[model samples]
Target: MKPLKEVAMSYMALSEAQKKLEEGAFGEAAGESSKAMEFSKTMPPGETFDHDGFDALCYAVLASARAGLGEYDACLEASGRALHYFNRRGELQQDEGKQWIAVVFSRGVAFHETGVYDEALKNLNMAGEMITERKGELPGKEAMLKEIERRKSMLLEEEKSQRKPGYKAWWEFWS
Candidate 1:
């Protein structure tokens, strides 16, 4: 098992990556994110059966790191894993709807940024529905979902005109 100190160090690295990204240093961010991901991938689910929120949160961080690296598919995989971990433990409310929606919207944003409009729309639409359905019931999510979909619509025309040749081959490889 990894030591707690080591774990904290890795987490600090992840934070640094986030800061670099905020500073527009994408290369530095990607480097730090890669280091963080290494530790996270090796982290055990633990000896006993406890889907504590920590594991889910770790996956969330991984998803964020992947997003920073422009690895949209990787981000989606990590986010979905996070969501699954939380769902299995019925930690949705504790994790909050916004966190889950964040997983979806982040994937959508990644897809959109990568010019994969079809995937972007699918995820954003799902997020929109989730946000709308939970808005009245969930806390801290009244505006976020609305904003994400609005952003999606802004790219509608751009996506429509982006159908390049042989995209299907690359798409299937990713799929």
Candidate 2:
């Protein structure tokens, strides 16, 4: 078994990597996140994610990191693994449910960012329905439904634009 301090250090490393990712340092963040994942395998589960959730979080971040690195399909597959792992936890477990919603939304956002509208819409709508059904009961669920709606609107516009003669890249302004 790994020492408690070692596990804590690894947890901090993953958090730092996520911060770097949010700050747009993709390469460094990916490396750090990978290291964090490897380190986490040695530790026992405490809270938040059971041992499995910890693994899923590791893989999910890896997938998001891959998305940031412009590998969309890999991101979707990896994020799917995360969602599956979360879903297997328990239907009554809102914590895991929340985690699934997050991965779904994140993957949807990533896919949409990379111009995969169909897949993005499917996942976004899935998340919206889940949140809508459990809005009052779920904890820490701020702005998720609204964000899903916003993404859906953007997707609808993109779909419209795709039918026109002059379709624009997803990253560009579409007005």
Candidate 3:
């Protein structure tokens, strides 16, 4: 079994990766996230290997880095993995909805970039609702709320553009 010190170091690495991801340093974030994941693998099986929140953190960082790199599919995969981990521990609604925020946001971004507008809007709205419900209790609450509003606005614009009238029906063209 790996020592608790090693687990602590892994979390530190994950934190660095998340910072790098937020800074738009995709390559550096991926490297740091990989190191954290590798360290997590060194722990012994059973209770000693319980990952607290490190697994979700690493996956969230990975997803954000991949999204920054324009790897939307990979970002979605990583975000899904993070969501899976959170779901397993029933932490999706824990911590005042903080735990699932990053994962949900990443999934929303990935879906948006991939042209999956419905899914994007759904996930983004979920994140927005969580942010709204948890308001003052969440760290960076204002920033998160602003971002959610921005994305929702963007999605609405895109939806409106798609619905704009222009083309004629086949029968009308024949007429």
Candidate 4:
């Protein structure tokens, strides 16, 4: 088992990272989240308490921070890691609604930043549904849901504009 000091430090780093993220300090948030992830990694595999959710949360923060810093590829990568951890946690038991929502929301943002409109909208929709179902558990639920809807609407418009009518063949003009 990891030392109590390491566990406390990990949580402290995570909280600091979250605060930095909320304050729009992307670089600092990323650093702190990385620290949290590093500490979490030191915990042995198959420990008494599964720390997958904690790892997922750290990755979610990192993803959002990367997105804020315009590191789309890194953001997507971190979001993928977050999703993997979240899935692992889910397989063991039901994940906390807040952690699940955070992971989904970060993934949606990452996808949106990477110009994957379809995936972004899908994730955002999932987050919105989760928020609705877990309304009592999520703080600022209305704002978060509104933001998801806004992103979905924006993606829809962008995707529509990017589409063009296609012809089967250049030679088959008019029959």
Q: lDDT per residue, candidate 4, 1-175, as tens digits?
A: 5567678888899999989988989999999999997887776665554577787788888887887898878888887888886665542224355756776887787788778888899999988877767635465577788888889989998977776766344567664
Off by over 4 Å in 3: 88-99, 135-139, 164-175
If scored against the real structure, what TM-score would every candidate get?
A: 0.53, 0.63, 0.78, 0.78
lDDT of 4 at 60: 83
Q: Weakest 10 consecutive residues, lDDT, candidate 1?
A: 47-56
| Per-residue accuracy of model 1 over 83-155 as CA lDDT, tens digit each | 7855565333343554566667777877787777788888888877777666346543655566676768767
TM-score of candidate 2 relative to the true fold = 0.63
lDDT of 2 by residue, 1-175 (tens): 5467667867787787767766878777778877887876666555333556666766666676777788777778778778777766634345446546656777888789888889899988887777766544654355677778898999998788668576566876555
What is the Cα root-mean-square deviation between model 4 and the actual structure? Answer: 4.6
Better of 1 and 4 by lDDT: 4
Report the lDDT tens digits of candidate 3 across residue range 91-163.
Answer: 5446614647867887898898899999999999988876766544666667767877898899999988886
Task: Give the runs in model 2 whose Cα sits over 4 Å from its true position.
Answer: 42-50, 90-99, 113-116, 129-147, 158-175
Clashing pairs in 1: none
Alpha-carbon lDDT, every model? 0.65, 0.72, 0.79, 0.79
Ranking by lDDT: 4, 3, 2, 1
Instruction: Output the worst ten-in-a-row residue range by lDDT, candidate 4.
Output: 88-97
